[model samples]
Target: MRFTPVVALAAFTASTTASVASDRYIVHFADAASARAATHASQFAPTERRLSDAPRHLRSLAAGGEVFELGPDEASRVSALPGVDAVEEDLMFEPTTVVASLWKRQWYMHDPKVGVDAEKAWKYTRGAGAVVAVLDTGITPHPEFDGQLLPGYDFISDAGAARDGDGRDADPTDMGNWSDPGECHSPEGKASTWHGTHMAGLIAARAGNRPGIVGLAPEAKLIPVRVLGRCGGRSSDIADAIVWASGGDVPGVPTLARRADVINLSMGTTGACGPLLRRAIEQARSRGSVIVTSAGNDQKNANTNTPANCPGVVSVAALGRDGAMASYSNFGNVTLAAPGGHIGDRGADDILSTWDIGKRGRERSVFGYRGGTSVAAPQVAALVALMRSADPDITVDQVTQQLVDNARPLPGPCPKGCGAGLMDAGATVDAVVEDRGRY
Candidate 1:
């Protein structure tokens, strides 16, 4: 059995698209003032039939459920209300996965931490105080990440936060594998979830613990924010989670996410980072969180992946075990490459790690091998955490800059996609040391 990340509260069960009809509705108000007004209270007098389940507005509404979804006529009536704003319909799009991870057993890879001719840059740097939010599947509690989770929030349908809903918090093997309710007999094989969980382990798996796998940052804490579920959340939900994780707004959602210095978006949409995602990333950047994302799995040049392609994000490309760029990795503007491993093969696929260990109703063997750039993103994220531990107050931009500055450039057809170069923990540590000395 393969274990990745647990998606929704329902856990193992899957959902058929046709089975659930996504309710489409509209919100109308008197004027721009009323409509754009904060989620606190609608400025206009809402009609009885007009109701809403607006994510941000419910809090200020007197009865909480006072706001209702109304059709056109009701919208028209509400429009006549004193402070009506504009009326708009809610548009929901399917959610997508984002990721990158893994690193171990590579000799040529920079390891200034314990090398004969180790660089002096690492002595002064060690990822001081940066917080990287892992927004993929769910993170399993492993001996490696024992004390690594900082403060995680589950965006899986909003109810099962932290706890997997089985009354326990970290059940490694009980991840929800992806299975398109009606995917079979389609094109690809049956879909499943938990790919996120397995990805998480690759990046932060405990180091030096004599464990199943080694991570990029053995000491870095994880902030598990679950944004995926059975099927997935609409764009709205993902956008909300992105903003909230970076210390932005969401009405009903308590301020669980503090201001993180960095955020790891190991997920992406087939579509680009649309308006909502773009806006959310911009807002979060304004608040100061270094956002890192996986370039994409599409094997095409100039292939732009959402959030990854979004402005001001560090998009990582994937590399095979032997240092050649993974042909499948999306390349145009590759930032750098780290070993993401080759699926179902060894030597050619040394980048491996322990996967979901405790999912329910599944076969006992959850640990297995797989590879890709999705596995590489987290490797960088865990590195960010270690850098934070070394210096907690480091600015998001500064950390990102250091990463770019220190990465060992790779050789390839298009170096652009690989960014500064392959991420080297020891090299990065050395650069930080130099950075601290200059400071």
Candidate 2:
């Protein structure tokens, strides 16, 4: 009837120094008293003494049945204990691309010929204090974000497209965009791309973790506004999201607690901008938020694209790793080109970013490659964040001017209308510092 005394974790660590595996096990008990009275301390070694670096006294072996390191035999014995409920292994997750395979793949972020020079720009600013609203499919929980992700609004409006079977509330998690052939009028069924997740990673995935891809602006915050869904989001829903993301008021929707300094529209439709879209952009502009849109992947004149061609929008085109226009990227009216990958690259020259490797019932966080104007736009959005971090008072007009002024000509033959030229993150942030110094 003797009970094991609850001793300091350091003492427990020093007392039972048995060889053990790296697997940490969680043992659940029916009650704290049963755990405290149990004499299983010798069988199950205390793993993490402190509960996330809490005080020593609070990390006793009997302190709320904390985690323990146990081998197979030891774990089995512990599971058979009188009051033990269950035993499971503790798992760690690093949310980013596989760095070994990704270092060479992410040439779009560093290659001077076509990349955005994120390395140099990062030296200037990592986009701290700035917020970029991703108006795309929702976002999911991942380790790539170090508490910099904000709870964003889901403006799907249509329950069917939402796939979550709800119109919209505050949950912006991307429920896989999987769809049947007839769903959303697509010619064939397609798996979800986790588009928003990839975009968010590009804008600000946690940096210096030593495992995965680093973002252009690692310290920036992301506000994921889920406007697009299953097949494609309705323009009405997208317009509402734009308005709400910029801290503008929308009927029936709650007010945004924080406004975005920059809004990214990676999705777009063909034809001129409609009244609904125009009104939302106008309102967002009035609130001092800059809107950045993809120049469409249709390989046609971007002037035919809706939001890209919208007044006051900074439209972006795509460039391949070779410093040439991506074959699929639409031209004309483009603000500038960023690495979006070319069709000829197959998977070799695609933009590498964070993604989920699973489909349907088996979802796991992993990194993959994708190419399109959609991928290109986030590069600029991240650059804008760095600019905001450097000069909080910088206006949308100033962003446009700085980009135009600092752009370099295309390395090879330029397309019909590549706007100013290529997006130079180093030059852009330097220009901001220079402008501030002058003023």
Candidate 3:
């Protein structure tokens, strides 16, 4: 009863200026001096010309490249000009063809070109026996996770941060994390977020259930490990949760019957990976868990963000519908990219997943859109689940290698480096299954 939808390929028609019949083109210059010389040359009419109806300047690249709207004949002339390295058409790219789903909002899951292509991977496995531990603000009960939830634990040490009036406990229910003005560091107040539930839904929300959205690995089990809370979470709590979630003992907390096949950490802070967190991640990886974490939302180098910067983890960066790195997503040192969606008009381009209605506390559940590297990490986590489901004996290194080897290049450029490329769930899972045949 998998919710397989008809895929719709978006057709794009290139348009030309009606007045001048011009198309966009980029002229790459050999050097900055050449670029400046071309601007003053009479043959090259730069967009800044005083003409009232002049060709538009689309963009100016920092590396002495100029994008302009030029007629085909004019483009040829520019290409033949001295000091011009090359002239190429400015091409337009969109997210891989979208799948028409029941909700129609899960574009990220269905985009086969730039997305993880979970739909294609589903033909092989739905991550049946894999377990994913979501370490975040915790989760709220929802219909999307009816039989997919595992007995999770609360690891928030501070009662105030937990907002549950207790220290550490077994209940991982998300007690609203609404904060007062200046409570956590910000001047304005913040809402509960329901961040964990959204991430869980991305990983394993049921597929054929009702009219709701489908997850990447619908059959994968989710263990909601509460670490973040009211303001945020502590490094110590997160470290302990990582160890316990991977079946390591955490003193009073009972050990998990099954270690998580994939550990999803969507939370992070600015600084080097602390010794405690790094050790915990190493321990989890040693136990055969594939750790996936967000590259952060600061749009800076990911090397400064904890857990993501730590070794032996897949630090993921976010991609928008245009197949480029999200404007707010961290770039350098990322393991790969995934559809994290973008802040579009009225939140049209954000990732669609399960969410709660309450602004300050738990209320009725609903489907909503959120955009960030936080949302991107879970998709890769689910992909790991699917890979494990395909070949249960695959080692953590093998899994990582398969992901890197099978990933396709981003449709656009990632100047700061986005690891291997974008994750291709179908190719990765297929490769794993094929490799299993060899053995």
TM-score per candidate: 0.63, 0.76, 0.76
User: How much lDDT does each candidate structure score?
Assistant: 0.55, 0.79, 0.83
Q: Candidate 3 — which pairs collide?
A: none
In the range 77-111, model 2's lDDT, one tens digit per residue, is: 55665556776665687855433335566787778
How high a TM-score does candidate 1 get? 0.63
User: What's model 3's overall lDDT?
Assistant: 0.83
Per-prediction backbone clash count: 80, 0, 0
Lowest summed lDDT window (length 10), candidate 3: 4-13
- lDDT of the structure predicted as candidate 2: 0.79
C-alpha RMSD of candidate 1:
26.5
Model with the higher lDDT, candidate 1 or 2: 2
Candidate with top lDDT is: 3
Residues 303-409 of candidate 1 have per-residue lDDT tens digits of 45777788878788777655667777777765666656565454524445555443432333334566677777777776666666666656667777878877765
lDDT of 3 by residue, 20-72 (tens): 46788898876766655444442344445432224445667875578767777
Candidates sorted by TM-score, best first: 3, 2, 1
